[model samples]
Target: MKTGRRLTSYALNYKKIILVALFLLTISVGTDLAGPFIAKNIIDQHILGIESVWNETTNGKSTAEYQGEFYKKEKNFSDNEEKGKEIRILQVGTKFVFMDEKLEFDGKRTFEQGILTVQKGDEKVNYNAKVLTNKELMAFYKLEIPGIIKLLIVYFGLLVISAIFQYGQKFLLQKSANRIIQKMREDVFGQIQRLPIQYFDNLPAGKVVARITNDTEAIRELYVTVLAQFFTSAIYITGIYAALFILDVKLAAICLLLLPILYGWIILYRKFASKYNRVIRSRNSDINATINESICGMSIIQAFRREKETETEFEKLNTEHFTYQNKLLSLNALTSHNLVGVLRNLVFVAFIWYFGGLSLNPASVISLGVLYAFVDYINRLFNPVQGIVNQLANLESALVAGERVFSLMDEQGEKVSTKRIERFCGNVTFDHVSFGYKEGEYVLNDINFEAKQGQTVALVGHTGSGKSSIMNLLFRFYDCQKGKIFIDGMDIINIPRQTVRNHMGIVLQDPYLFTGTIVSNVSLGDPSISREMVEKALKDVGVDRVFKNLENGYDEPVIEKGSTLSSGQRQLISFARALAFNPAILILDEATSSIDTETEAVIQEAMDVLKKGRTTFIIAHRLSTIRNADQILVLDRGKIVERGSHEELMLLKGKYYQMYELQKGNASLAG
Candidate 1:
């Protein structure tokens, strides 16, 4: 799906609220656009109506008294009223003149010596006119006061209604935008969980963090600001065009030229802006990744005295990010206000030409009210135009961010299954198993092994000898490319990964702890594990002896990675966590390599007791640690070269015997 369509789908999730908001927006635009028309009515019908012809009348209402005669505007005269000779009241410059005889033609007027000369083209006519005093002019204007005041009240009322609806639409639109972003973040995070571990091996944690946070935030602005401006501008522009056409079709047709010009500019601007914005967003992700890597390896960098080098590397990424941002800024500066200003100027030029050459002629009947409304609507038209132009940058940014977000969502991921199964007796087997992280390259050769129920098997190997790889296959982190792995004689590949992992647990050489209390980390907030169960697991793993000095005991807070705790403390908590889950199969991957001797003894004692009815696989480099194993497999180059109990291997004087003797010599030399 297109990024725009995907974003629209998210919006549709809350279509009810969004549709209601759009309805309010339309009403708001309608009420606001009514202003110019109402002003036109006030100017033409009520204020300028006095200039029209008046007739002598006997009607008492709506009459202006002059020279002992009561006269009413021709428009105000009712049917069946007594009629008298028509007279005119016209403005000659700043002063009002009364003419008892109506002129044959009306044009540009000049008044002097009590005569008004009206000229149109080659025709000229004169009327004997009387200039009214301020008091007499007041009588003519007084008749319009009530009507003008009523229209003014209506105009203000419409403004109030417009404001109310405007506020409603903005509030509702923003609310729905927040809700959409909330759901999007949830989906993105859930997708991350469903993704395989290999995905994280390629993408840095910070880039993933940026996707969930920074990218989604940009999308939020898309819904709240960019779309809001676009919608409002669309409605406002449409309303203004309708009003313009009503006032004068010719001028409105001229104004229509702006639409295509604006559309073309948008297409052109996006062409350049999209390229710059993509680089900017990509660099932003790079900067995040760099910062995360720096923080995580700060100790290593400082210990090696590479701080200056690290700073230089980070500055390089930051400089690239800054350069692209400036480019985007320049693009915006060149286009936004400048484009709107140019368009505004062009429309105004057309406006002045239209009214100057065609509408302002003496023979033209176009009223001053129509001219005022036209200018008003033209000026109003640019507001929405400017709004749209200003928001173009945000629009592009949102689209790019949405594309990134949806791409992450598009990655192939396994569906997490919640189906539970009864715990099976641990009888794990690898039958002619072969696997590789990359295609056509086998990391583990065809391997065969069987670990019966409740048996403990120890794997001794150097790094890159496929020890951890074997455990990875068993846990279904990655499936074997050839052969099969089974538990209780059922092919593991046939089971859902989550369901298979349900009865398995592992502890790593470097244990990972979350940000929570020790008890919470042990139980992992699982409802099935009670506080008593957590305490019992901690006790079984000798965690209480190590953590007894702490103030909160098992409830003591553990910060990120358990950074505040000792390595031994973290490992013990990890052990407790595994014990709490009570997995049927447990793999300890070099679990004791980093521990001090005393802590190692504590873990060994706990392991001796805990290994009772569970199949345990231990990957170890310390030859002394697995001496009593029921079976010991010594692997080299992804193949098992030797296998037996420790004493049997010692008697054979083989590869295992050589490894044990080498470790013993190292220990004797250190002593």
Candidate 2:
């Protein structure tokens, strides 16, 4: 019900179109039932009725009386039922004489144009009376031909009108459904922006993509197929019931008993169907996640020669997804359209037996026309019921999609304060900070650090020593569990995330590049950075030497992830990107880790220019990279164990000094 309500809220935005469709749908359904009713009328009143045989020789009206009412009156009887309802002859000198033998119509009636004839004067009309006996007599009572033509005209006209409205209703519904899908997609994409980083850390990339794209598309089917058909079917069922009740109350009452049985069957089907559908959806998400991972890691898989292993893992996920889909298919086969078909056949069987018993009893008041109409109405009712049953799978899929979409929307993200700070001094302070990425597991214990404006602070340690963790806290990616971080002597926790990150620029060990021109990647599409400025920044960072031979220079197109570029080229471009931003607080996380020794040797000039007036924090494994740092903090097991200049740290011969000696000896051995 909650899923249904959420979908309804999206639908209500386009209610005007929906309401128009509904009105047209009602008209179309009402017109459809008219065909069966018209057939009943032609069978009961026109061809099969006690039609008169008129004698043209007689002048004026012969007073023919039945039930004490004169039906042979010469006046027009089309408007007045009482004056001449028993019989009607519209021509002058017309007389229709009632015969003694009254034969009821036992079969169907077929009408033809320009074939009806009436005997005039004493003309002897020799007709073949032995074979097809009623053919000649049917022509004799053909004086009511004009009235039958009028009824046919009305019936066909209604059919044309019904066709028009049916087309309009379908077209409008499709348009409304498309608009609704667009809105739903927009809302899902917007919700993705508000989710936390940790939320993404737990789920796979492909799973998130499936929810944003594939799942929402499933909901689109809910609007197009399930919604339109379900609404039309409901209206059809109601119209069918009303027609049946008007025909005969007792028969309609018996038909109503089938509702509870149908409802119970639906309940049973949904119980199993929903469960299998959920499993199918979950497996499909897993399949998407696996495929995305495989594609992204294809280069690694091939380089390491793990193609067979990767293929085997992908096959396992695919097989699991396929197995669940088969289970859902099996569930559908047992209890969907087939079940509705069974119920329809049973209803027809019951209808026949009940009506047959009435036909045998002499005291029963029934007509063939009424029985024919009832059969038509019952069939009409079950047709839509079958359609609705067939759409059950779509409803289940849409509901599951809704649940996933809403779950992402409900996740808690960083509380972004509205207060803005356009600029900040480069000063940063960590006051007795203690932090952890998980509950009750402190990765950074009682950490204290400080970097004055325009000073370079270098963090060096072995792996898992929390050097990167300190940068994470400084950038406000994750808040510390205890104590506070201050910028320019003011706590930054109350500042908005966008505002705080605006003055910071980060260049990481592995720089990510989007599909675009090199200049756009360098400037990151910032309008303030002109083309000339992007060029200058690239030159300043020594990236021009790497791509000088490329055709378009900085304007060259970069393919996905910049896969065509060398590792050094990618890292150099990242440096230019950070330099172009000119952030007050600069962080380099092994930023030069990928560059060759010769290229790194030249980029030092660009690095000095970038860190000139900004508070810079360098996280590096190479002790040679931090030789000129104003302050060096050596971390061990989440605590800053030593703090001094590079020369001062070498004198202490502590953990930092030991790491320096090992790397220096390793380089000497390789040379």
Report the C-alpha lDDT of model 1 over 1-671, residue by residue, as the tens digit.
89999999999999999999999999999999999999999999888888888998774999999988888888777687777889889999999999988767667899999999988777788889999999998888999999999999999999999999999999999999999999999999999989988888889998999899999999999999999999999999999999988888888999999999999999999999899888888888988998999998988999999999999988998899899899989999999999989988988888888777874476667788998898899889999999999999999999999999999999999888998888969999999999999898898998889999888999998789999999999998898999999999999898999999899888999999999999999999999999999999889988766776898877889999999999999999998899999999999999999888888998999999999999999999998999878888888899988888989999999888888999999999999
**Can you give the lDDT of residue 647 in candidate 2?**
95
Q: Distance (Å) between predicted and true CA of 343, model 2?
A: 1.2
lDDT for model 2, please.
Answer: 0.78
Give, for candidate 1, the lowest lDDT window spanning 10 residues.
355-364
lDDT per residue for candidate 2 within 1-671, as digits (tens), equals 48889889889999999999999999999998898888788766655443433222222233333333433323333354333223222221232233322223212222223121233233222221121124433443454465578778889999999999999999999899999989888877776765656577789989999888888888889998999989999899888888988888887888888788877877887787788777777878888998899899988989999999988988887788788788878888887777878888888888889887775654574666787788888888888888888888888888888888777767776544455566678999999999988988999988887899999999998899998888888877778899999999978787766678888999899999989999989988889889888888888987766676998877889998889998888888888898788789999999877878977876777788778889999998888988999899999999999999999999999888899999999999999
What TM-score fits each model?
A: 0.98, 0.87
Clashing pairs in 1: none
Show where candidate 1 strays beyond 4 Å: 360-362
| Shift of residue 523 alpha carbon in model 1, Å | 1.0
Where model 2 places Cα greater than 4 Å from the true spot, the runs are 49-148, 363-365, 415-420
Clashing pairs in 2: none
Candidate 1 positional error at 263, Å: 1.1
Model 1 lDDT on a 0 to 1 scale: 0.91
Which lDDT value does model 1 have at 376?
Answer: 90
